[model samples]
Target: NKQGRRQSTISLSTGSGEPISLSMPASGERRLAFMDLLLKHHINGGELSEEDIREEVDTFMFEGHDTTAMAMSWIIYLLGHNMEVQDRLALEVDSLFDDLHSEMRNESNSSSTTEITLDAIKQLKYLDCVVKEGLRLCPSVPLIGRSATEDMTISGHVVPAGTVIYCFIYQLHRDPEIFPDPEVFNPDRFLPENSGGRHPFAFVPFSAGPRNCIGQKFALAELKIVLARLIRHYRFVSLDQP
Candidate 1:
């Protein structure tokens, strides 16, 4: 019970201990419990060992929490400066929840029983458009690096093998052909009519293909839930000049 004693000691040692204790959950305890569950289920099994779990936890804790927090910050900043977009998002969320509620009633299910289904979240097209456009404008990780496995020719220039390549996602997102009038904060660019014909690599916020993020879906779902809840409760202020 070292963890319990440590928490208790920390709680008693501080001047503003009550607030600190209230503000922060016992993360150590929570993490241990999560690990116990994972071990019980043998979730990682042969794919990962104890050391692998440590490394994965380190990577995920840093990448997942920091990147998502930064993304949400950018989204808030964008929404604050774009009233029309915020209004549209709010309306979309309202309509989706109303429809979801109706569907639940028709199915004779409790609200808790009717979880946020993939189809339901997919139907939040406008909200999804806003998120896509936000990522296009201010991607969380602005740049990424890769090393060449073999000699390659890019733009007719032959590059030696094992060369480090820095891909600028910011510049890619600003390409005129890929995103017409790319500087504009227009979510309509992600509309089904406009997006259907565009090149797939035009938007690589979460990178692309096999090397892409495994938590992309989880991240997007978390974002949508937070945004939907926030919009339903509060109308965001637009701080930009007309």
Candidate 2:
């Protein structure tokens, strides 16, 4: 190994002699793991301790796992019932398939996310809308609470400082004034032309403002890549009574 660094390998395979496909870093570049980054800060940056690393890792696992899994489940459900929507998305996903090999995946901005190229994921316009619509219909956290720092008036009502404001995302998403026929699983609502006029805070699946969820972009990237792969490989249909 270069610079007296020993390389190691761990294999999870049977000796059946089947070829394996995995994307790798460029010829001379080495990849860094998430923990490696944390360890680097722990040692060099001196900002993260061993305990801090452990807690951050735990938070990453806990926050990123179940909620993303649940979002995928709900998106799958929506795709199943909405065959036309799924078909359109499938066409979009398929158009990008030629550019992305079936086994194609490479690390993006974060290792704790799906490995598909960020550029490829960005090309998934319909899938992006689908995920947003899915989250709107089935947000992981149905409600969020925030405290008002200053007195303000909303809807012609007065509010005082230090007041706890509970926003019911479940109900907010279903408001017909904001989203026409909100109950319908419509991804078009997120299209740029249609969404341009919507208020920034109109959609708050991951909360909003400075105190928002730190992992919002990470979670969205993860969900999009995973869903892209799944939809490319399988066609889902609802089994429920029509």
**How high is the CA lDDT of each candidate model?**
0.75, 0.79
As for candidate 1, its clashing pairs are none
Q: Which stretch of 10 consecutive residues in model 2 shows the poorest summed lDDT?
A: 5-14
lDDT of 1 by residue, 118-225 (tens): 677778889898888989999988888888999999999998999999889999999998898998889999998999988898899999878987888988988877
* Cα-based RMSD of candidate 2: 11.1
Off by over 4 Å in 2: 1-58, 99-115, 152-160
Q: Locate the minimum summed-lDDT window of 10 residues in model 1.
A: 5-14
Which tens-of-lDDT digit does each residue in 1-242 have in candidate 2?
Answer: 25533322212232595533212232345666675566556556577765676567656665778788888899999999999999999899887875454334442333242345778889888889999999999998889999899999999989999999999998888989999999999999999999998989889998899988898998999999888788878999999938
Best candidate (score: TM-score): 1
Q: How close is every model to the real structure, measured as TM-score? A: 0.75, 0.69
